[model samples]
Every structure is written in C-alpha cells, then in structure tokens.
Target: MKIVTGRMASALRLACMASTVVLLAGCTRYGQHGYARYRTNCGICHHGGEGMKGEIPPISGRVDRIAATTEGKQYLMHVLLNGLNGPLDIDGVHYNFSMPPFRTHLSDEEIASILSYLATRGDTQPVPVFSAADVAAERAHPMTTSMVAEERRRLDALHPLP
Candidate 1:
C-alpha cells in the first residue's frame, strides 16, 4: 500500500509539472504573437533579425534593457504612437535614423503587442498587455513633459550629445 501511495504521489507531481509547463508555454506563445506584430510594424526600422545595420538599431533583444526602466517603457510606447526621427543611441552606438510614425498604420492593440514583445524578448520582465483603452488614451493625450524628460535622460546617458 505504501509503495502504491508513493507511486501515486509521483504521478501527481508529474501531472502538476506538466500542467505548469503547459501554462508557461501558452504565455510564451502570447509573447511570440506580440513579437510577430512588432516585427510586422516596427521591424523596418528596428530590425528584428540580424544582418541589417547603421540605419536602425537591432530592437529585438537590446530594446528590453531600455524597456526595463519606467521611462524607457513609456518612451517606447510614445515612440510607437508618435514616431521620432532624431538621434537614437542604442547599445552605446549612435543611430540617427528616421522612425516614421506608425500611428495610422497600426492600431493601439498592435502597438501594445509590439512593445510587449520588445520588452519580453529583450528582458526577463513580463510587460503588461497593451489594451484598447491604452490606445485611446495615447491617441487622445499623447506623451507629456515628464515622459519626454525620462526618455531624453535615458537616451542621453546611453549616447551623449556629440
């Protein structure tokens, strides 16, 4: 009876582990979808895969570092909403490429997915899902002074003014 009980316990443990793995897998799938959305929308400038250079920063993994910060996250969202074509210092390298606004091209959910993918792929952090309300808010108000300050400070630190 004891041996049978032990076997049952082991089976239960295995089942629990399997379920947990499945759940984590689902979350990963969601992140991947978000990544795909980002690639479709922002990959032109950000470059999802290797090979491209000089024109824009490789946003796949490097962006997570910037997204980890509060201001960095907001800056990413703002950039998606209101694209910037100024000096960008990514991974200590200066990239002065123009990132045309994708506001009209992608909906807010799409933008959120891209940002979420960037944050997740770049770092171990789990970013909040972008919602329809988030899109509406950004479109209605856009970024304010404080958000801009945070972005500039972080970017300046990465790539000082020449």
Candidate 2:
C-alpha cells in the first residue's frame, strides 16, 4: 500500500491552486476577441491605449473623434495597413515614433476588431465602427508608410484634428 505524506499532499494542492489562478487570470484578461488581439498586438507600444507621454499617441478618446469623419476613417485604415512614420502631433503633443504595419500579421477582421475596441475607450460620443470590409478595401490598395503619412496630412487639412 502507498502512504500519502502531508508535505507532498500540501505541495500538490498548492500547485493545483496556482495553476487554477493563472488560468482564471488569463481568461479574465482576454475575455473579448478584440481585447485579446489588441493586447497581443497593440498593447506593447500603446499600453492598452494609455500610451506613453509625448511618444506613442493615445488612441482612446482621440481615435473616436478622428473616426467620426469620413476622411479620418480612411486615414485610420491606411495608417493601420501601411503604418505611420515621421513626427505626429496629437492634442498639441508631438510623437515621432514609427508605427509598424500590422497588415501582414493581422487579418482584416482582426484589424477591424482592434479598431472597434479602440473606439470604445475614453470616448464620450458615438463613433463609427470599422468593418472588416473597410480593412479589406484598404488592404486591396496598399500604400507606403510615407504615403500613409501624406494621406493623413491631406485628411488633416480637410477634417482637422480635435
């Protein structure tokens, strides 16, 4: 007959409890599809939309406003598909970091979901939701990062940022 020891039993119980906690934590953190994708992809630099001061532009409230306009919406799609380079001024703060393109890594659906997720954050009014079709359209006509930047400049001239 095998004897069960108290120390071994306690250690096993602790290990099981630790694993359960970890699994639950993961489920809680990645509860939504968009949130999970955003966490894995955009969270590294944007910090879940909390963005670094004067570095990464915070996409929370600001994105929703930008997305409110037609030109801004197309600009957003181009930026995501082609990435953005050079200096960007958001709400009077300057950010010069190069945003990497995610078109290669993420599907149209995923990009739309991430953009939708961003729209919900820090937004007080209703914002246009990005659809997979929108992303696909942008994907069909690929642009260089510099071109994306130029498009943004044109959009800014037309719509202006708030």
TM-score of each: 0.63, 0.77
Candidate 2: give the clashing pairs: none
TM-score of 1: 0.63
lDDT of 1 by residue, 26-121 (tens): 454347667677667666555653415666667656556666555555566777777665555555676666566667788877777776655565
As a whole number from 0 to 100, the lDDT of residue 89 in candidate 2 is: 88
- TM-score, prediction 2: 0.77
lDDT for model 2: 0.80
Model 2, residue 120: C-alpha shift (Å): 0.8
| Global Cα lDDT for candidate 1 | 0.63
Best by lDDT: 2
Total clashing pairs in model 2? 0
Least accurate 10 contiguous residues by lDDT in model 2: 23-32
